[model samples]
Target: MTGTMQLAAEGASDHRGLIIGLFGAFVVATLAITVWAGRQNKDADDYYAGGRSFTGFQNGLAISGDYMSAASFLGIAGAIALYGYDGFLYSIGFLVAWLVALLLVAEPLRNSGRFTMADVLAYRMRQRPVRTAAGTSTIVVSIFYLLAQMVGAGTLVALLLGIDGEAGRRWVVVGVGIVMVLYVTVGGMKGTTWVQMIKAVLLIAGTLLITVLVLNKFGWNISALLGAAAESSGKGTAYLEPGLKYGISDLSKLDFISLAVALVLGTAGLPHILVRFYTVPTAKAARKSVNWAIGIIGAFYLMTIALGFGAAALVGPDRIIASNAAGNTAAPLLAEAVGGGPGSTGGAILLAVISAVAFATILAVVAGLTLASSASFAHDLWANVIRKGKASEKEEVLTAKIAAIAIGAVSIVLGIFADKLNTAALVALAFAVAASANLPTILYSLFWKRFTTSGALWSIYGGLASSVLLVVFSPVLSGSETALFPDSDFAFFPLSNPGLVSIPLGFLLGWLGTVVSKEKADPAKFAEMEVRSLTGAGAH
Candidate 1:
């Protein structure tokens, strides 16, 4: 028994080394590219959008890279491994959100805006308040997203390298931060775009390979594989049957709804995703990019179903619980089991590749988020609003770089503080805030003539306030005894998710504010906004 336990520990350690080495190699390569690109960043436009030269296909690939974060890679697979069919709800919500982007939000946003979403809203409204609010929202959402990514990176590195906790996480954060600063400051959009495209391809290819292998191991039988997973999961027929487990008050049900709301609405409103649209040369290209993104994202989500079930059945829950503690490590462990033991050549190679891909995914996404947040602060608010649009291109780019570093540091601090929280849940909170605070103002500004500046202001403030308060009182936040409300661990609301409640309130507040301020609203300015956003009249 002692020898067997020792062998298991040794096997896990060897697997960790293999994965860490592969991940390290990818980080070095990304850093080199970022540095090379940074040397060529000549102006603000270059730093912001790679001089707006990307084609639809390239931009589409980059979008996929940005969209697939730690949540898509680690969280989804882990959830599926533990919870069975409930995990697929995340895939469905994510895929559906792209439709909202494609059919409603994509082209108009591209046609109306230049660098930031604030630019779109401020095109007609008072630029000061609009830029300030937008910048604040961008920073808030990006920081939230960044913290989640940093925490995941740290946890993953520690798990993969067998390093001590803080050491592993700090190294991962610093490595990722430097690579991102290099990508945005030097290569600008061009470098970021290429990196994203490469990462997306790697992620998709790796997932497909794993899915195919898993299915083959199950005798190419989907139903039988699911049946086995359902039985093993202890969730009974509810595991296979959709909505049959409705109204259960278990942790599984709570987690399922929270995940669904965050994945769906969050994708549509993310600052990094909105910024990607600016890289495309035309509004039509922006539309095309979104369509391609939908198809790619859809395929990836479909593959996740197989990967999750494969982990649940073949790896077994007991081993997963003992090894991962959080159950998120099930996918990689399952990969090793499928290929053979960790010391086997095939198992080691696949494990190495998956870890490398995960590392690259986090790096690409954090870079994009940092760039967007930096641009919002330096370009939209500081350069344009505070400097009265007087700063030189060099000064503006310098400011953005400085902002990126500062934001990166802040994210590291937050990541350390929130280490115990789940990455998926934190990311969902960020999405809820984005959907609540930013999306409503953006949609109304472009489409509603009655949208007064006062309405926009109130909407931004109201949404931001409500979402933050809800998150603060959420089960995830308040459930901990050491958290902000140590005396009261139970949330005021049973549900941790706020999107189901706060998103609608944002829209309603915007409309009400607009209606109340109708007399003060500019009619001619509203018409011009409609033309610019809807007809491609001013697009360059």
Candidate 2:
């Protein structure tokens, strides 16, 4: 037993060297891509919307890269390994949400907007107030999304280096934040989009490699895989069923419902995701991109089922839990196991390759989130509100770069504080906030002729305020062992997610604010917006 333990330690040391080397290589390659793309930017369009140059397939792939975040990879895999069927449901919600983006938001938003979502929201409303609200909500939602990627980075680096406790994770998070700010400030949108397209391809290829290995190990028999996973999960048949994670009690069930709502409705409102639509040249390209994104993203999520169960079957649930306590390392551990376990060269190579892909994914995502938020601040708030549309393109781009630095610093701080939470759950809270604050205002602005400037302001501010406030008092923040503040008990809200209540309230506030206000929206402007949205008559 002593000899075997010594051998395992030696193997882990070997794997660590290989993993770090691969990580460095991937980062260098992506930075090269960023620098190469950055040299082409000549104006605000190039920096903010990739100069509307990407094809449907390219933009589609980038969207897939941005959407298949660390939450989709690390968080979802960990959830499934621990909770079985319930965990896989997160994939279903995410995939369904894309349809909402495709059918309702894609063409219209592309036709109506420019660099950011505010361009559309402010089309007919009071520009300064609506832009302020949209800018604020965009930054807030992007920050929430940024936290997930940063936390995932910390967890990934910690697991590979065998670093324990908060200090290791904190340093990793800060490093990730710095790297992301560099990606945004140097590359801008064109550079970032190219990196995302490359990252998406790498992620899908890595996932396919692991999925195939897992299937082959099970003799290509899914039933065999399921049986082994169920047995190894230490829950027998319950591991393959629904109640293991979420359906146990009324509160858990309600939490599940809220989670589903957020995941399903949140994609359309995501600032980074929404901004991707503006990167294409035509509304047709936007629609085509959504189709491509759906196909690519759908296939990736299906592969995650294999990843999640493979981890359970090969790595064992207790070992996965022991690794990070959040299951963020399950996919990487499973890669090691499938390639012949810890002591072998095959295991080291696979682990290094998989982990490298994960690092690249996190980097690319953080770049996208930062770019979106900074664009909102510079284009919507700084240029339009602060400078009253008089800021030069050079000045606007400079402000965006500075905003990226500030946002990166803020995300690094929050990432340290929220490092204990699961990446997928952290993203779910972000989704809830986006759904509550951004979606109702977007939908109303596009569809309702009576939507006044006050209605938009009320909806955006009210929804944003309510969801964020609920999260602070909810179990996600305190009162439970898994909460961010585990030592305290200030949780007053019962549900872990606030989507179920906050989303409806957002829509309600928009309606009520419209009805009570005496100010009339510009009918001529609404007619023009409708024509432009539906028929692409005057799209930029």
lDDT of 2 by residue, 1-540 (tens): 123223333456776767778888878888888888889999999999999999999999999999999999899999999889999999999999998899999999999998899999999899999999999999999999999999899888776666667887799999899888988999999999988999999999999999999999999999999999999999999999998878899889989999999999999999999999999999999999999999999999999999999999998888787776777878888887898888788877787788789999999999999999999999999999999999999999999999999999999999998877899998999999999999999999999999999999999999999999999999988999889999999999999999999999999999988999999989999999999999999798
**Which stretches of model 2 miss by more than 4 angstroms?**
1-10
- Give the alpha-carbon lDDT of every model: 0.77, 0.91
- For all predicted structures, in order, the TM-scores are 0.92, 0.98
Task: List CA RMSD, all candidates.
Answer: 3.0, 2.0
Regions of model 1 farther than 4 Å from truth? 1-9, 12-20, 242-246, 250-262, 480-490
State the lDDT at 103 in candidate 2. 91
Give the lDDT of residue 134 in candidate 2: 97
